[model samples]
Target: MRNALLAISLIAVFAFFLYVAVNPGDFGGNTGDHLIFGEPKYSDMDDYFIHNGQNQTGANNIVTSIVFDYRGFDTLGEASVLFTAVLGVGVALRLLRRDKNDE
Candidate 1:
């Protein structure tokens, strides 16, 4: 069980790295704070797919499909991470609270 858990952890890490390497976070160009990310002239191909996606490809909720399809595994991992963080926060909050009598 321990080995299985460790292997999965490693695989998840590797998969994250592999996806990042393939999908350039910025297409070797400027993706700065000033950019709105969907400006027609400045946008990357990904932005085009996201903006005009639903109409172009006849798919509804383009953002949802993008989040779960092309980047499905990554998004899943990120969601798992957020869930773990929230769970930890809840557990910590519960532990930190004092009972009325204790206080």
Candidate 2:
């Protein structure tokens, strides 16, 4: 019953997002409303990154350039966190299995 409810909830959420993407104006109440959610009013920063990211970072992929060059430290921290979590999980499971075998 819980799984069924979760599946139904997931489907409803996906359908809502699909409807919003297909008919954004319906959710916005206007075709060009920019108060909360609509087309971006300012894209100068994004434009600059796209145009100069390759040359500035010497990376052919703009996304990669931004992630590894502009936000290298942030990405490194996230990777470190993920590695630590996986290591912890592995150690904990190994100790648990060892305890079960000894008992």
Candidate 3:
């Protein structure tokens, strides 16, 4: 009984994946909201960064300007979060190893 239930669940998950792969654009609900694969959704923000990023940030590289100047706080927050996660994992592993050695 357990094996049969597991097989059914696996088949259902596989069918969901296959459906998503076949109709990637059907997620938006509306007919006009379909997104083409591999094409970027261009917005006014993109244009603004491309045209004025250098002038505003004084950085010759557009990517650098956006990361450091336009989104500096966001980037800093992401780095902090990543660092905390790594530290947490290290502490957890060290404690586990110590406990194993004690046993």
TM-score of 1: 0.41
Among these predictions, the greatest TM-score belongs to 3
Residues 1-103 of candidate 3: C-alpha lDDT, one tens digit per residue: 9679989999999999999999876443444544644355668998999999988999999999999999999999999999999999999999989988999
**Candidate lDDT values, in order:** 0.76, 0.87, 0.88
**Worst window of 10 by summed lDDT in candidate 1:** 33-42
Off by over 4 Å in 2: 1-41
Candidate 2 least-lDDT 10 residues: 27-36
Cα RMSD, each candidate? 12.4, 7.8, 6.4
Query: Which tens-of-lDDT digit does each residue in 1-103 have in candidate 1?
Result: 9679989999999999999899856544546655435544555876778777786556688777677665779998999999999999998778667543378
TM values, all candidates? 0.41, 0.59, 0.63
Predict model 2's lDDT versus the native. Answer: 0.87
What candidate 3 gets wrong by more than 4 Å, as runs, is 1-37
Task: In angstroms, give how far residue 27 of model 2 lies from its true place.
Answer: 10
Clashing residue pairs for model 2: none
